[model samples]
Structures are given as C-alpha cells and as structure tokens.
Target: MAKLKSLMSCAANRLQQASGLDQTEARIEIRALMQHSLGGVNHAWLIAHGDDTVTDALRVRFESLLARRIQGEPVAHILGRREFYGRDFAVTPDTLIPRPDTEILVETALDRIPPDQACEILDMGTGTGAIGITLALERPHAQVTILDYSEAALAIARENARQLSAHNVAALHSDWFSAVQGQRFDLIVSNPPYVEADDPHLQQGDLRFEPITALASGTDGLDDIRRIVAHAPMHLKPSGWLIIEHGYNQGEAVRSIFSGHYFANVHTVQDLAGHDRVTLGQLT
Candidate 1:
C-alpha cells in the first residue's frame, strides 16, 4: 500500500525523467492527476491527505493517467476539463484546449462591451465556446453566438454552454463568416489557427495531441488571420470591434492586415508574459 505523498513523488519523478518536463511542471502535472482521481479536490486536500494509503485500484488509475501524460497527452485532455476565465470548461480532442492567454481576449472583449449594453457578439472559430460563453456569462444581456467549422467542435462548445448554463450563448457551425451571412455583430472575436504549418513547436509537447486544423494556419501562419480580418468587416457593424488572438510574433503582420483593410483603432496587446497575443481593430 503506497502512501499518497510517496505516490505523488514517484509519479513526478517518472514524468520529469521520461517527459523532459522540469521539476516544477512535473510536480504540477502529478498534482493535477491526483486531483482528477480524487474527485476534483484542490492541492490543499492533497496536502492534508498525503498520509492516506492509496488503494490498488486508485493507484492503477493514477498510473494510467501518468502513462498518458508521459505520452505527451495534455493534462487538460486527460482530465476532460480546463479552467479558463475563472470557470472550468469541458475539453476534448475535438477542440483546442482553452488556454490562459485566451482569457486576455475575453477580458478585452468584456472591457469593450458594457454590462448594461444589450448587443450581439460573434466568436468565430469558437472551440469549446470558452470566449463566447465567457462573454455571455459575464454580460448576461449580450446575445453571444459561437461558430465553428467542425461539427464535432461545435458539439463540444454547445455542451459546454449547456453545462455552464450560459443561456445567452448560441453555437453555430460555419466556416468563418459563411453561416452568419447578413448578420452583423457589435463585436467579433476569435483565437484562430495562428501557428505556421511547419512550425517545429507543432511537433512537440501538447501540440502533438491537439487538432492540427485548430493550430496551423498557413505558410506564415497568417492565413486564417488574414481571412478573418478581410471578412469580419462585412459582418461587423460600423464602429464594431474585431478582436483576435494570434501567435506571439504576429502583432506587426496582423496590425498591417487590419490597416490594409482600413480598420480604425487597430492595435495589438501583449499577454501576461509580455508577448503580443491579441490584436483588435474597429470597423469604421
């Protein structure tokens, strides 16, 4: 009978040795696995239960999860949930895992749309409905619609909205602006595929398990961004905002695309890491 603390230590050591993850990340991953197996308990619970004996069945389950982590499967995918914008969003292989950087896009959108305003918001390429659902929940008066190209992705987004009880959110299946023809919105936001087709990072770590269509854009990784910037103006009302989350190094190119399209107030904002992550423009 292994103790909980010993099991966690051994698992963290195995992950650090086999997955090339540093000690801190390995520990974090081990803690996440423990939390998953222990009924979503927090780290404090783990600390309090460190002396508890691990049953054979539970140990086997934890080991299985550890094996998946060693295989480069994302902890979010393994646990089936990811916390974003102070909420836990359901996740699956069908959709991109909701990332912390995307919260910036949500925050920016919330800042733009006032709480009392009853407006329409569109979240293009919404995977897991994190952005649109967050907006809807944050501003209950706003009518939020999230569109995805993949039906599987749309299903996950819809289920997330249902689970979160976000009544203001609606999920639709569309490739970009195709399905929303003639429907103008007060705000349009997306965290589209912005990674280069051949980017080396795609072959590494968690990206290996994520859907390629949700990550890679084009040769320079600006294909989807360009398409969105070109088409969003038509779907956005005059003075409406279009906010997009892109690769860290894509600020200049994205801003240029916005400028070429004659968008007003075009600008790029950095994430918590000081890397440019989101770019926005207004259709004037």
Candidate 2:
C-alpha cells in the first residue's frame, strides 16, 4: 500500500515538473491514470483505496500512460472519449475534436427547423458525429445524414451514433455532396476545414495532432467553405437553412459568399467568447 502511493507521488511530481501543468491538473491526471489502470474504477473509490498495493503489471501500465501524456498527447485521445453537447463520445486521431463553437450551429439549426415537421438534415464533414448525432437525438422526427471524406472518420462517426443511440443518423463517405446527389435537406450545416494552410497555430497545441485535411482549407482557408456554399443551394429545399462555423475573421467573407449566392437572412452568430464563429443563410 505505502509503496504504491510512493510510486504514484513520484510520477506525479515528475510529470508536474516536466509538463508545467498546475499541481491540481497534475494530480487529477495521475489519479485518472491510476483509475484507468484499475479497470476503469471510479475516482472516489480509487482515492479511498488506492493506497492498497497494486500489481507490478498495473504500475507499469500507469507509467506508460503517464509518459505518453507528458509528451503533449491530448487527454481525450489518451482516454479515447470526448464530451460534446453534454454527451460522451468515442474519439480518435481519425476525427477532429468537437469544439464548443459548433454548438451554436446546432442550436441555430434546431431553431430554424420546425419540430412538428419531419425534416432531413445534411451535416457536411461530420467528424466525431457531434453535429448530426446531436441533431438526431434532439429532434427524433429529423433524419440526419453525415458525410465525411475519410473512411476512418466515418467509422468513428458510425460508432459514436451507435453509442449515443442516435439511430436516425446515416453516415456516408463523401467529399462534400458527392454521395447524396439528388437528395434535398431542410437544413444543411458544416464546420469544414477553415484554418489557412499557413496558419502558425496549426503547429501548436492539439491542432498539431489533428489531420491536416480536417484543419487546413487550401491557401486561404475559405476554399472548402466556398465550395460548400456554392453547392448547398442544389441540395437544400427552397427555404432550407445553411449554417456553418468558421474562424472569427471569416464572418464577413462567409456572409459575402452567401450574399453572392442570393441567400436571404444571412447573418453571423458569436460564440460564448463573443467571436463571430458561425454564419447562417436561408436559401431563397
């Protein structure tokens, strides 16, 4: 018992010093590692009885995970789960992390779609199944189709749908609208790759771990957004809504794209941070 505590304390201290995280974060991560090693036991149970000596095998496993986390790996990837829209989702390197800004797009879409009406929604580049699955779960009457270019990402999205019990969602492997030709949607939403290829932020933090194709959009970062706007009218019902998340500086450009396409009620929504993170337009 005493030996296990000593080993954990030592590892936590080393991780704290090397990673520069605060003491609280370091302790939480180390305890999470211990809990993971104990067959996914609750943190409270582990804290109450963790002093009990663990097997040598468990100690080795804990150390391996700690080492990996110290190397700048995202904890969500390490734990294989990310929480989105108040739901836990399985995630992997193949899909992008579900960001909070995306919730605005979801909320806006829900507001625009009539609950009593059976609607079809198209979520382009639906990584991790966050947007489409959330919509399906929120509005059971709605049928959602999620499209992604990467087969691996689609696999992850499918798993998330099954895990979330979002049976109304249909996952497809498509580059934009290729797989759903001749189908029309009442609402079309996307958070496509909007980061410019030359953005320095891409080389820092968790962005460094995400796939480039899921982050960068040509040289201007608006290439995918442009393509989506140009093609959305064809797939949308006459009055369908098109909502999208983009960089804060992209609101004007996105609004301009919608204006050029003759969309009505084109406007931008600010995220919690007060940045213009989402833009919406109604097909005229």
Candidate 3:
C-alpha cells in the first residue's frame, strides 16, 4: 500500500495535469475525494493521518473518484453534495450545483428578513433547496416555499431540506409561478437561469455536466428573468421584496425588468467579484 501523502500527491499532480487546476486546488480536490472515499471523515482526520498508509480499499475508491474528476466531472457530482452558506446540501445532475456567488443572494435576502417575524419567502428555481433552506434555517420563524419546475430537482431540494433539518420550508413543483397562482409572499428570491442559449460557455467545464434548463434562458438569457419579474408583482405582498441572481453582465437588463414592472427600490448588488450579480427590488 502507498503512503497516504504519496498517494495524495500523485493523484493531485495527475488531476492538475488533466483538469488545469493549480497545485493548491488540485490538492484540495484530492483531499476532498480522500475524505469522502474514506467514508465521510472530516478534514482534521486527513490532517491527523497524513503520514498513514492507504488501505487497499481506500486506494481503489479514491482512485476511481479521482479518475472521474480527471474526466472533468464536478466534485460535487461525485460527492453528492455542495457547500453553500456553510451547509453541505445534497446535489445531483438534476439540480444546478450550489455555487459560492449564490450565497450573496442568500445574504442579501437574509439581511432583509426580520428574524423574529413570520416572514413568508418563496425561492423560485430552488434546485438543491440551498437558498430557501438556508433562509428557513437562519430565520427559523420564516416559512419558505421552495419551488422548482423539475420534479427530480424538487426531490433533491426536499431531501436537502429534511437532511438539513430546515423544517420551516416546503418544496413545491412549479414552472415559475404556475403552481402558486395567487399566493403572495413577503419576499420572493430566485437564482434563475440567465445564460443565453447560444453562449459558448455552455459547452465547457462544469457547465457541460449541469442541466441546461437550469443554466440557459432565451436567446438573450433574460427570458426567464423577464418572466419572473413580470409575474413577481402578483406573488409579492405590497411592500415586500424581490431578489434574483443573474449573470454578472446582465445586471442592467434585470434592473430594467424590475423597474418596468413597477418594482420600487430597484437596485443591483455586486458579488465579491465587483460584477453585478444580484438584483433586488420592492413592491410598491
């Protein structure tokens, strides 16, 4: 059996060569693969045993997962979960992988919600229940409705809610507002599909593996965003808020959609990248 450190180093180098990840990122991915293949052990365990020898079974499982990573599969797909807002939420190809930038949407909405009140929130396109579940967990008094068009995605969302103990939320199947026709919410948040259908990025990297419907909208990528904004006024309680995530370059268009829909306090929030990433507005 190879030493754990040697095995990790070899796998990391191979992954880096295959995927173009830098040394540090390659090592991190290898570490995550190790922790998972070793049956969900924590990072400290890997640190404590860095000098240990790898068991044959562990070597086999780790190498198998590493091979998948080398083939460009997302680590979250291999591990079956992704961390968002500091929580590991279950994920699958059926749902969009929870990304760090989406946390900005969560934080922006979380800051707007009063902690002690029974705020009603609707998370449209809640793929893994990351947004709605995090909101419900953060503001326990808040009741969040997690809606998705895909039943498979909604199943993942529901499972994530239960696994995370986010009891204050409900997962509903809907194509946008189809299932919630007249239901008004104190806040409506969405990380909708905003990538243009023909965008070349869709053919590369992790995008290659994610569901297309969760990533692309219409030709300009604003079709779903427009639909969400156009129908938001009916679902939002007067004086309530609407927050949505979009492509960094599409902020101005999203803000215009909100403004044209008569949403007041319309504005866009930039993620850490200084790119406009989230747009929010309030109902008059």
Candidate 4:
C-alpha cells in the first residue's frame, strides 16, 4: 500500500490534468475526496496524518471518487453536500449547487432584516435552501419562506432546512407565486435562472452536471427576472425590499426593469468579482 501523502499527491496530479485546475485548487479537491472516502478526517487531520498508510480498500474508495470527478461529475454532487455561508447544505442532481456568489444575496438581505424584528422574507426559486436557511439562522426572529417549482429540489431544500434546524423557514412548492396567493412579505429575494438558454457555459465545467431548468432562462436570460420584477410588487408589503441575483452583464437591463416598475432606490451591487451580480429596490 502507498503512503497516504504519496497517494494524495498522485490523485491531485490526476485531478489537475483532467480539470485544468491550479495546484492549490487541485489539492483542495484531493482533500475533499480523501475526507469523503477515508471518513472521520478533515483537512487538518489529513495534514497531520499524511504519513498514515493507505489500505487497499481505502485506496479503491478514494480512486473511485477521483475517477468520477475526472469524468466530469460535480464535486458537490459526488460529496452530496455543499458549503454556503458557513453552513453545509445537502445537494443533489435535482438541485443547483449553492454558489459562493449567492452569499452576496444573503448578506444584502441580512442588511434589510433586523436581528430582533419578526420580519417576513421570501426566497423564490430556492435551491438547497442556502439563502433562506442562512437568513433564518442569522435572524432567528425572522420568518423565511423558501419556494421552488421542482418537488425534487424542494425536497433537498426542506431536508437542508431540517438538518440546519432553521425552524423559522418554511418550504413550499410553487411555480412562482401561485402557492402564496393573497399573502405577502416584507422582503423577497431570489437567485433565479439567469443564464441565457444558448450560453455556451451551460455545456462546460460543473454547469454540465447541474439541472438546466435551474440555470437557463430565455434567450437573453432575462425572462425569469422580468417575470419576478413584474409580479414582486403584488407580494411585497409597503416599503418592502426586493433583491435578485442576475448575470454580471445584466446590470443595466435589470436596473432599467426596476426603474420602469417605479421602484425606489433601484441599484445594482457588484459581486466579489466586481461584476454586477445583485440588483435590489424598494416597493414604492
């Protein structure tokens, strides 16, 4: 049997060659695969136990995962979980993997919700329940409703909410606002499908493994955004806030939509990449 350190180094090299990832990212993937296969080990533990011998059984398990990744299955899907805003959210093929960029949506929503107030928040198209669950945890007093059209995706989100003990969050199935009917909320946020149907990125990288219905919109990728903006006023309470994450190049168009709807203080916020990622406005 090979030493654990040597086995890990070989796996990282194979991952790097297959995925074109840098040495740092390759090592991270190796660490995640190692932990998943070996069990009971974290990054710190792996570093401390590098000299441990790799048993034949453990080597088989580790290589199986690495091979799957090399063949293009998403790392999150393979691991059955994803980390978002310091919480581990269970994810599957039915649900889009929670992304780091969406954390900006949660942070912006946090600014709108008070720590002590019993605010009503809506998370539309919620997948993995990351945004809603994180907000519910952060503001224990706030009630968050997470809505999704896909029952399978909703199952994953509900499970995540349960595991995270987000008691203030409720999961509902709806094709948009159909289930809410006459109800309204003080705040509504979403990370809806903003990728153009023909966008080449959909066929590349981890995107290839994600559900297309959760990623692609209309030809220009503004179909869902337009529908959400048009219908949001109906559900938002007086002075309620509406925030939505969109494609980077869509800042101008989204801002214009909000303005046309007579929303107040309409503007766009850049992500860590400095791309216009989230746009928000208050109900007039």
Candidate 5:
C-alpha cells in the first residue's frame, strides 16, 4: 500500500515538472489513464490517499511516459486512441490526429447528404477512418469508401472501422482515385494535407509526431486541396457535393479552385471558433 502511494506521488510530481500541467490537468489525465486500464490506477489512488512508498520498476515506467509527454508527444499517440465525432478511433504515428475543426467538415457533410438515400460517399485521405467511419455509422445505407496512400495509415483506419462496427465503409489503399478507377460517389470529402512544407507549426506539438505525408502538402500548402478539387468532379455524381477542410486562410483559394470547375454553390463554412475552415461546392 505504501509502495503504491509513493509511486503515485512520484508520477504526479514528474508529470507536473516535465509538462508544466497544473495539478488538476495532470490529475485528470492520470485518472483517465487509470480508468482506461493502463495499470496506473492503484498507484494513483494510493497516492491520492497519501501513501508514499513505491517500487522502482513502476517509477521508471511512469517517469519514461512523463518524459515523452514533456517532449510534446501527443497524449493520443501515447494512449493509441482519440475521440472524434463522439466515436473513439485508433491512431498512430502513421496517420494524422483527428482535429476538432475537421468535425465541422463531418457535420457539414452529414447535413448535405440525405440520410435516407442510398448514396455513395468517398473520403479521401481518411487517416484513422474518423470521417468515413462516422458517416458510415450515421448513414448505414450509404456506401462509404475511404482512400489513403499509406498502407500503414489504411491498416489503422481499417481497425477503427471494424471496432466501430461501421461495416459499410470500404478501406482502400489508393493515392486519391487511382485504385478505384471507374467508381464514383454522390459526395466526396477530404481533410487532406494542407499544411505548408516549411510551416513553423510542423515542428511543434503533436504535429511533430504525425506522418508528414498526412500533414504537409506543398510549398503553398494548397497542393493536396487543389488536387482534390481538380479531380473530385471526375469521381462525383452530377449535383453531388464535394467538401474539404483546409487551413483557415485557404478557404478563398479552395473556393476559387472549385469555381474553376463545373462546381456550383461554392462557399466556405467557419468552424465553431469562427475560422474559415471548410469549403464546399456541388458538381453541376
């Protein structure tokens, strides 16, 4: 009992020192780690109870995790999971961490597509299957196909799909539409790599641990968004909607890309934070 208490105190101290997280945030995270059965609960509970004698082995492991977190490793990567659109998804270094801004994209897509209609939807660059899987779960009758270039990313996405029981989603290893040549969908959505290659943010926080292929587009960061806009019309049914998430400042550029095509209703949607984060257009 004393050992458990000591370990918890040491862990909390190390986490606080390493990450500069206040007592409340650190305690909350530690509690979640315990609740998730990561084997730290007994120590945490004992520590909270004022026990102070912990084993060397447990101390070493806890310190290691604290060090990693202090280095800016995302908690999601450390835990191997993230919650997106009210669903938990398996995440890894191979894919991008699903962001809250992207939820606006999913919500927008759900609003645009008719739930009762048996429509085909395509999710391009579906890292962790968050967008595609959510759509499949919400619109069971909709046939959803998720395409990603990286095999490792696709593997994680497939696992997320299975875990969520979203059977209607088809995971495809493709660079955009290359593998699914003749197939088309009633709606196409993507939260593709829109970060500029040399963006300073890429060197910081969770982005540091994410795969570059899933984050950086090109010099201007519009490379992937432009490609999706240019090619989406080819894979979208007439009158279908193509929605995309981009850097807050890229909305106008994305909308212009759509205007150059046969797409109509070209516009942008702001996220809850009031950033122009999503752009949508309909195939005419």
Candidate 6:
C-alpha cells in the first residue's frame, strides 16, 4: 500500500504525462482530488500525514477521479460544484461550469449598480445562476431574474439559488426574452454560448462533457449574441446597462454589435489574462 504522499506523487506524475500540465498544476489537481474524496482533507492535512497509509476506499475514489481527469473531465464537473465570486455554486452537465472570467461580469454589474438602490437585473442564459445569484446576495435590494432555454439548466440554477439562499432571485424558462415579455430591467448580464459550432477546441478538454447548446452558438459563434443584442434593448429600461461574456476573440464583433444597435458606452473588459472577455453598453 502506498503512503499518502507517494500516492499523490504518482498521481501527479501520471496527470502530467497525460495532460501536459506542469508539475505544479498536476499537484494541484492531485490535491483537489485528495481533498474532495478524503473527507475534505486539505492540502495542509495531506502534507501533515504524508506517511499515513492510504485507505483502500479513499485510494479507489481518488483513482476513479484521476482517471476521469486523465480523460479530460473538468475538476469542477468531477466535484459537482464551482466557486464563483466568493461563493460555491452547484453545477452539472446541464450548465456551463462558472469560470473566473465570468466573475468580471458580476464585478462590472455590481460596479454599475449601487448596492443600496433597488435594481431589477436580468441574467440571460443564467446556467448555474452564478451571476444572478451572486448579484442578489451582494445587493440584497436587487431583484434578479435569471433565464435559461433549457429546463434542466433552469432547475440547476434554481437549486443553486435555493442553496445559496438568494431570496431576491427568480429562475425562469425563457428563450432569450420570450418569457419575460414587457418586463424591463435595470441591468442585464449573460455568459452565453459564444464558441463557434466548429471550433476544434470544443472537441478537446473539458468542453467535451459540457452541453453543446451551452457552449456553441453558430458558425461564427455570434448567433445567440445577436439574438440577445437585438432583444435586449426592448427588455432594458432607458439608461440600463447590458453586459455579456463572450469568447476572447469575439470582442470586436461584440463591441460592433452593441455599437450598431445604438448602445452607448460600448466597450470591452479584459480578463486576468489580458484577453477581452466581457462587453458592456447602456440603452439609449
């Protein structure tokens, strides 16, 4: 039987060989699996108990998870939750795993709308409800409505809203603005499907397990964005802001769409990697 540290080292080496991840990243993945499967044992605990023998059951679970990771499954998917904006959100195959880039949208939305004011917010294609729920929790006075075309996705979002105790949020089934007809919002945000249908990257890595509808838009990956942009003005109050997460390469196209629609203050915000990740504009 391998000791805890030996098992971790072996797992990390295998992960490095399988995924081309550096030693540091591989160790991080190993630590995450250990923490998740070993009664929430953290990195520090693993280090402290380096000489401890690995339990058969725990080792089996870790090996299973490592095999899934070797096959390109995302750790968030394997763990069944993702952390976003200082909170953990339940995620499943029905929804896109909330990414750190999307946090910029939440931050931007919060910055635009004052926390003390009563605000009506719409999260298009809300997925796991990360953006909408986080906004509701951050600004308790805000009423957030999250829409998703998929009932399965909406269910996950609703559950996340419940788990997170976001009382100000409501999840609904809507194809864009269809279900919310005639309702206007102070702000609208989305992390929609912007990956091109034929993007080769979709066939690789974590994208394989994620729902295609939640990841791909069209040949240009702008179809859903176009739909949202066209309908957003109708659902947004005058002077209301609309912010969206898009593919890094889609920034110029997104900015053009907003500008062409006569939206003022149109601009893109870069993520931590300095890649354009979010675009925002205000209704005239």
lDDT of 1 at 150: 95
- Listed in order, each prediction's TM-score against the native is 0.97, 0.88, 0.97, 0.98, 0.86, 0.96
Q: Candidate 5, residues 74-191: lDDT per residue as tens digits?
A: 8788778888988889989999999888999999999987888899999999989999999999999899999999999999999999899998999999988898788878999999
- For model 5, how many clashes? 2
lDDT of 6 by residue, 1-284 (tens): 88999999999999999998999989988898889988787678889999999889988999999999999889888899888988888989888999888889989999998979898999999999999999999999999999999999899999999998999998889988999999999999999899999999999878889999999999999999999998899999999999999998999999999998869999999999999999999999
RMSD in order of candidates? 1.1, 2.6, 1.0, 0.8, 3.4, 1.2
Best-performing candidate as measured by TM-score? 4
Each model's C-alpha lDDT?
A: 0.93, 0.89, 0.93, 0.93, 0.84, 0.92
- For residues 56-119, write the lDDT of model 3, one tens digit per residue: 8888899899989999999999999899988999889999999999999999998999999998
Off by over 4 Å in 6: none
In model 4, how large is the Cα lDDT of residue 176?
90
**Can you write out model 1's per-residue Cα lDDT over 1-284, one digit (the tens) per residue?**
88999999999999999989899989998999989988789999999999999998889888899999988899999999999988999999999999889999999999999899799999999999999999999999999999999999999999999999999988888999999999999999999999999999999989988999999989999999999999888899889999999988989999999998869999998999999999999998
Q: How many steric clashes between backbone atoms does each model show?
A: 0, 0, 0, 0, 2, 0
TM-score leaderboard ranking = 4, 3, 1, 6, 2, 5
Model 2 TM: 0.88
Residue 112, candidate 6: C-alpha displacement in angstroms: 0.6
Question: Which is superior by TM-score, 3 or 6?
Answer: 3
* Clash pairs (backbone) in predicted model 4: none
- Looking at candidate 5, what is the lDDT of residue 93? 93
lDDT of 5 at 23: 89
- lDDT score, candidate 1: 0.93
Model 2, 1-284: lDDT tens digits are 34666777887898889878888878877877777777788777876775677777887888788888888786678888777889988889998988777889889888987777799999999989899999999999999999999999999999999988998999999999999999999999998999999999899767888889999998889999999999999999999899999999999999999999969999999989899999999999
